[model samples]
Target: MTRVMNAYYSNLIEGHNTRPRDIEAALAGRLDEVEDRPLAEEAAAHVRVQAWIDETSSRGDLPEPTSVAFICDLHRRFYDAMPEELRFTEHDGQRKEIIPGAFRAAGEEVSVGRHLPPSASRIPAFIDHFALRYRGLTSGPTGRILSIPAAHHRLNYIHPFLDGNGRVSRLMSHAMCQAAGIGGHGLWSISRGLARGLRDPAEYKEHMDAADQPRRGDRDGRGNLSLSTLTSFTGWFLTVMLDQIRFTEAMFDLNALQERYTRLIADLYPGKQRLPQLVAHVLRHGEMARGDARFVTGASERSARSDLGELISGGFLKSATPKGALRVAFPLDYRERLFPNLFTDAAPIVPAPPPPPPL
Candidate 1:
């Protein structure tokens, strides 16, 4: 669920507003059902990249998040999965191909708004320095946690990729937080906070732009960039992260979850007194023997089977086989009701249409 939200908000921040419904469809191999195929493809690619990061991290085989090689891999994995039409960027009326895992060529010069990135030829050296400096800053967990925002900003400053630099930097920051032991196990997402901008989305971009300013005088840090401005950006970034953490924490609290879960069961299965307990059991235990539903609900086998079938058809429960263990399921159509405020789209959620026949 957080992965879907992350993909939605991250793509939204990049000006591609792929909704959670579309992302969910894409993940379920129903791409043909999604209305905006390109955007759905991008959202799907983002989720896949994050999944790779999580799996690699779990296996302890992840490359250093700050390393250029790891950064390029993030960009490569994301764009490589993108549709052909989305893999190119246009500048000054000219179109250029974005090499998935490669930095901009020597002659490819570019500017972002008012800030001119270093010439493409110099990106390699800048990236090397970036990795080294950050390695030193992140030698300890304390340093690692504190350096997240700075590293995020500095990576964007380097602008290593022809495009997709923003996405790559956000992914790197997420990995950094995970390595630092502050990732909340994917329970919370920084991209949501960054995209929300605490109120206006421009606030995020404004801070990034401010941090790009040159040294503001002797009082600023010794670097060519302004330390005071970077410090300000860091403070804002940390505040946003803390806010997201608190929001997710509150949403998942035991009492809060129980209340919401109860409400959802009641609303979805109104007047069905037995479903709440049965569903709650599956929710708590992860899965339950299908035959045991009769015992859990205090109903006869026939009635219990009927009740379970209803929940399964409603997308509230799932099973791999006719007699398989029943597991809790939160279908996209019911996500907003089950987890309010998780999505900002308030327009009535038309239940997702059925998928088209396979080609």
Candidate 2:
């Protein structure tokens, strides 16, 4: 048996270079300025705070800070392909804005395993729920850590953005952790867990099932998400996040790497089957011949060709015709340098630095 598993997500946050790794690297490189990135840990932490603010909304007279305007602004500034200065401004005085229904792309989806289409009509309330659940405010707006999984369910239910809701939702979950002062900067990235969800739909379903229901028949038993469900969802959320932290701490964990690549690829191609693998094959040598993709995936040449064409259409793979040769190029995110040991052409892989040496 050719026991190959999906490795698409390995590069989203950090891990070995595989097909998905190349794609994510490619996406980030294109979206982010390559020359001078802020410090790694610092950038990651800043992203979590911005993400949390994006997911929350003023509710229960709690001075909710999660708003679509906030989200849009944060996204525009933090994740935009252009410079941060051009993307966002002094948010302190920006007018509150709604996440336009035009947030998702024409065929975008909330989950690769499911679809919760975006609707402007239903978004406001959904945004409210996101900030309130498990939120305990001390001085500022609603604040609390309700576990990443709980927030993920509500995020899907609302389906705020036209295109990047899932990306925002996942980021929002990490933000929840950051707000609790537990990490100040989120300690984990759920992009890895999403990859696990892709590999085991059953496990994913079981986990989501616990936290996807309504709480204690509130006001005529209408809502589906319950407090109990939230707690259950939160528990698993922490566990999975911790798993990712530990796996990375250990220097190398193939399972975690596989999880990252699968999730990253899925995020790119939501409903497309075997798309992540297709992405991986293309990056075997940092590029692929469209005609040879079939050999790598055992699919017909037509199918292989279609895969490349689709990736090109999806912005994951770029096409360039070099003198006398046709090549499909893969995106490279230099941040993968964070893990130096995973590639063939670069410097030798070194053991990742020890975890802060215990306090």
* Collision pairs in model 1: none
In angstroms, how far off is 200's CA in candidate 2? 4.0
For model 1, what is the alpha-carbon lDDT of residue 241? 80
lDDT of 2 at 236: 62
lDDT, candidate 2, 84-106, per-residue tens: 33232222255223232345433
- My TM-score estimates for the predictions, one after another, are 0.92, 0.42
Kindly report which residue stretches of model 1 are placed more than 4 angstroms away from their true locations once superposed.
320-322, 345-359
Q: Write down the lDDT that model 2 would get.
A: 0.46
- lDDT tens string, model 1, 94-196? 8988999899898888898888999999999999999999989999988988899999999999898899999999899888888888887777778988997
